[model samples]
Every structure is written in structure tokens, then in C-alpha cells.
Target: MSGIYIHIPFCKQACHYCDFHFSTSLKKKDQLVFALAKELQLRKDEFKDTTIETIYFGGGTPSVLSTNELQYLIDSVYLNYKVTDHPEITLEANPDDLIINNIDALSISEVQSLYKTKFEELKKTGINRLSIGVQSFHEKDLKLMNRAHNAIEAKRCLETATQYFDNISLDLIYGIPNSTNQEWLENIQTALSFGIPHISSYALTVEPKTALASFIKKGIIDNVDDDLAHDQFHILIDQLNQAGFEHYELSNFAKKGYYSKNNSAYWLGKSYLGIGPSAHSFNGKQRAWNVKNNTIYIKKINQDQLPLEIEILTKNDKYNEFIMTGLRTIWGVSLTEVKKQFGESFLEYLLQQANQYINNQMLCIVDNRLKTTQKGKFLSDGIASDLFKLR
Candidate 1:
């Protein structure tokens, strides 16, 4: 089965640590939405024979769009492609966009009714899942990251979201500078308190051009401590496991039967089409990405042209990707599949490189599948890089 990823490249404001391509201005929103639809029609033949099992609305902040605008884009997909019945449709939202304002005069039940009305409208758009970006539940952390939503909005959103959507996922950031392990633990507990089924957490890495990186460079903010991050990651795993969530991937924990189908398709190397600026697509043997500029993207699409670059994957490139994605999940690299797809030499080379990690108890072959040990889960990416067959 395949999937389609729609990139909504607009946000209300910039976050301190984000480097994703987006515009804070909404002046071009209408034109860009139309362009996205046209591009889907223009590329219908690419996935003509593939049944799309997941439709993901990802972005700078997909919640920035109105329900009608979102439905328009979803309708565009149905018009051009063969989507499976009951496909998993996910919209990535920010807490501020999802919550309702509390007017002092309005009763608590009246405010809740407004929230219900809002999310019900979203449900009508065929979005069955909501991935809310609740990076932290701490007020200071929100300011440090320049996230648009405050701590109150984060908690308020989840309180109502869980009442409406069954398949919900929330994001958390573990390694914020100066954040104590206790604070990190509190974040995890706050998320669990909402009964959210899936959680995707990551370290707060300083991307090169983002504001966080510059702040650290100027000594305005301290750099993220790797040692502290390591401690918190383990704390996260322990807390979630005790709560009966599966640590299915490096940064994702899910209750049984609640894993993200869209993201899992990506890790499994299934073909998918990424629509909009700065989105990436992979069709097993090849990969493509659109230009990162919104104006240029709309201009090109209006002219019935694809403003994207494509690359045909070399064998080593495919093998390296498989190894990288494989090691990060509970499902490890398959020795037999490697031999079947890449020949004996590549398999032999992989085993040869992996032998060192295996000897150190960081990796082990169970049922002929090479997987990282619990001790090595945090280092899977570094280990996978060592196993890559460089040309």
C-alpha cells in the first residue's frame, strides 16, 4: 500500500528551533491551496496503479487552515487518485489553533460546546487522526522555543481532543537546554494524563540556521546537553513502557494498535507522493522533492509544470536507507531480504561491518534479523551509519 503526504507550508509564527520551509504570511494562502490541487491532478498518473492507504497533512502548521480549505484539498486528492476506503487521514495541528478561548462571561459547558463544534467540523473533513504539537507543558519551555501556544493551551487542547478523536498522537521535546529530568518526567506524565494513545518525542537539536542555533552561538542560550538528553530518553522509555505503550521506533511510543500508519509506511520503504513545497516523495527506486519557495511553486504549478528535482536511487543509496530506517525500529534489518535484493557481496559486507557492534552487545541477530539491543537503541543511527556500504 502507498500513501500521500500533503505539506501545508504556512505557520502563524516561527518556532525557535524549526528549520522547515514555511511562510508566516497568509497573503498567498488561497493561490497556494489552488496550486496544490492542480499539482495533484498533474501527477495523477504517478500513483495511478497504487492504492493510497494514508493521507497525511503535515507542515509548518496544518492547523492554520480553515476546515473548508482543508476539505478542499482532501477532495482534490479523491478527485485525482485511488484512495482506499477508510484510509488513515492525519492532520498535524498546533494546540493554540485547536483550543477555544475562555470568555470570562461564558460558562464552562458553553466553552466546551464550542470546542466540540470546532472539532466536529474537522471530523467532517475526513481527518480521522490529529497529531497535535504539544512540545512541552511548561510555560518557560514554550517561551524558550518561541512556540505560538502557551502551556495552558497545550493542556486544554488535549483535554478536548481526546474526547473527540480516538487515534490521536502528540509530540514532546525531551532535551531542552536547562530542563531538568524532573521537568521532562512531568511532561511525560502530563501527556499520559490525557490518555493520548501515541507519543512522538525527540531531542531538541540545534539546526544550523534556526534561532536556537544562533542563540547558543551568541551564548544567549546554552547548548543542549547530550548527557542529559540520554538520561531523559531512558526515562521516557521507562515511563511509557510502564504505562503499556510500545517503544516501536526510536522516537515513537504507541499503545497497541495505535501506531501511525503514514509514518510506518515511510520506514517500510513504501512508495508515496509528497505534495507542496519542500516535500519529499519516494517510489522505491527514486526520490523527488519540490522547490522550497512557495511563490515559485505556485508559479510553476499554474503553468502545468512540476517544480521539483528527482534522483534515481543507486543500489548503495537504497541499501543505506534500508539499513538506516531498519535499525531505528523494532523490526530490524532482514539478512535474507538483503541477500535476495542486494546479492551475496552486500550481505557479507553488512555482516562484516555489523560484527563489531554485535560483539559489543549493541547489536544481535535474532531469527536472522539484525536488531539493536536495548543498550544500543539510543545509538542506532550512529551504528547504522557504520554499516553503510560507501562507494
Candidate 2:
């Protein structure tokens, strides 16, 4: 259940809300690509005994790279590591990159006809799944977020992508300022129309130093209403559940047999290697992350050095992470496993800390596993922190 995550640290333009490490320039594209392959080769021994089951291309925008560049990286993975026969290879794409023809003038049928070639080229590169970032279907929402594509382009991309890839996922953001409840519902319904097997929806939080945060601070845009976000979160859960999608994690919903293997491995605490700038990796006992600066990452890798920092997890660190990730998903924390792994003292501390929430009916024990009640799902993070064994 191990995986590899490759970060593509480039984008055509910056999204207003994004604070991730990436540059708008393609000047270093070639060097970065070569460095990525070199890094994979250098780190092969780390996963010598592990079989890679998933290869994920995540980013600033992985689709910004050409099919050839993507194929080069995939080839590097096969050359360096042992991959499973049916590894789930995913590419996070934007609608603008997926649609070759002008979406504004073309009909859905016409766009699909023109778009087949691009998707076919992508599929030939061994990419079996596509996670498209179609944040909203309304022009206003797109404009507010400064997304790369319009509402039409989003719909057109999905209309065509569905024909080529069965295992497709789309992203949607809830809790935008000035967005009404009805508008939020419309966004959900429109995404469901695409018939995507998996959906990763998130509440839009204004991170510090991001344009969105600055705008709210200066009155350029209204601040995100917490009450509105809370309402929309419930709206999302109810709508998706009725549509026959499993609310597998706090923010991800999927049809049966379509859960994201890469992400599931992450939550279950499986070992994985993170390649590329700003990517994080985890084994059961330790976690590491690459340098955020692309130039430094490339230079270090070219010099046969890993520009990364490692953190050896203490027993409490592992326990806290398990509780946080565990409570966020349907597969809750196993009390027996906790005692077995972290010992009776750690397990006792966890149960003592969790008793308050359990009494409030926000958390409960089912088959000896600690899980969040529906009433507490939206507050899982807060509850998990409360249950943490802080020193």
C-alpha cells in the first residue's frame, strides 16, 4: 500500500487562494524534469523492499507539463522502483489544459470531439485516473476564486474526460464569501452531473499571506462566514450521501470501489516517497519534506543530495497523528491496536481525553474503534486536537 507523490511546481498563473510552492515561470522546466528523474534514481534504495501501488502527480498544476514530460517521469519510476501491475497513476489537471478547443464557442459534443486526442495522449502515458480541478460551475465563483477556467470550460472538460477515463475525480470548494446556500447546492448538483466516480470537496479557508486573506483584511472582499461554511459542509454531506457516494473521509466522497488509493494509503499510515519540491513523505515512524524552493531542490538533487528535512516521530507524535487522521475517516482508530502499538499508558491517556467528547455524543466507540458522530464530523479536527496527548 505504499505510494509515490510527484509534485509539479509550475502553473500558468497563480490562483488567488493558493499558497503552495510553485512559480509561474517555465524557465526551469527542463532542468526540474531532469532533476526529478535523477532524484527518483537516487532514492530507489529507500523503497527497495516496498512495492509501489500508486503514483500521484500533484501540484501547482501537473497538467501544465506535456505528455512527453509526464511519460518521462513515469518511465523514471518504473526504472527505479518495483511498481504493481495495476498501479493507480493519477494526474491532477485543470480544465483549461484538458480542453484544446475554445470552449466558449463550441458545443459540448463539438468540444468532446476535439478533446479526445489530448486525453488519448494522456492515457497512453499510463495515467489511468484524472483529478480535475473544477472548483465551481458558476462564473461568479470562478471569478472570485480567480480559477484558471470558466464554468463552460469546466463542464466541457468533464463531458469529454468522462468518455476517456472512468476513474475520474473533481474538486469543489464550498464556503465562498457572498455565496448563497442555493448557489452552493447548485455547485454540488452540477458536479454530480459529470458522473465522476470520486469527488474531493473542501471548505475555502483564507490562509495567511494569500491574496484572499489580504482582500478580506482590506475590505476588498467580504470575509468568509464561518456559519455559512458550517452550513455548506452539512449540505455537501447530505447531498453526496443521497447520491450514493460514500463519505469516506471528511472532505472526500466516492462511489463504491472508487476510493483514492494514494490518499487512502496516506490516512492508513502506509510508507510512501514524496518526490519533487515541497512534497512530504511518511513511513510509519518518520516523516520528511523536500525543500520548498525549486531551484534549491534541483541543485541539491543534481549534486546527488536530498534537499529535505526528516523528523523522527516520537511515540506520542505517532499517536496524535493516528488520532487526527483516524477520526477524519470512516475507518476510525482501533482501540486495541492503539494499546498494542502505543502501550497501555498511551491508550489510557487517549480514552481519558476522549471521554468528554464521548459523553457529549460527538464521538463514540463502535466495535472498539473510536469514530466521530455525524453531529461531530464537521468538527473532527477540533475534537481530535482535544483528544491529543500533549506533553
lDDT of each: 0.95, 0.93
What range of 10 consecutive residues in model 2 has the weakest lDDT sum? Answer: 108-117
Winning model by TM-score: 1
Task: Give candidate 2 regions above 4 Å deviation.
Answer: 103-113
Q: How would you encode candidate 1's per-residue C-alpha lDDT over 125-174 as one tens digit per residue?
A: 99999999999999999999999999998998898899999999999998
TM-score of 1: 0.99
lDDT of 2 by residue, 72-166 (tens): 99999999999999999999999999987546788878766667778899999999999999998999989989998999889988988998999
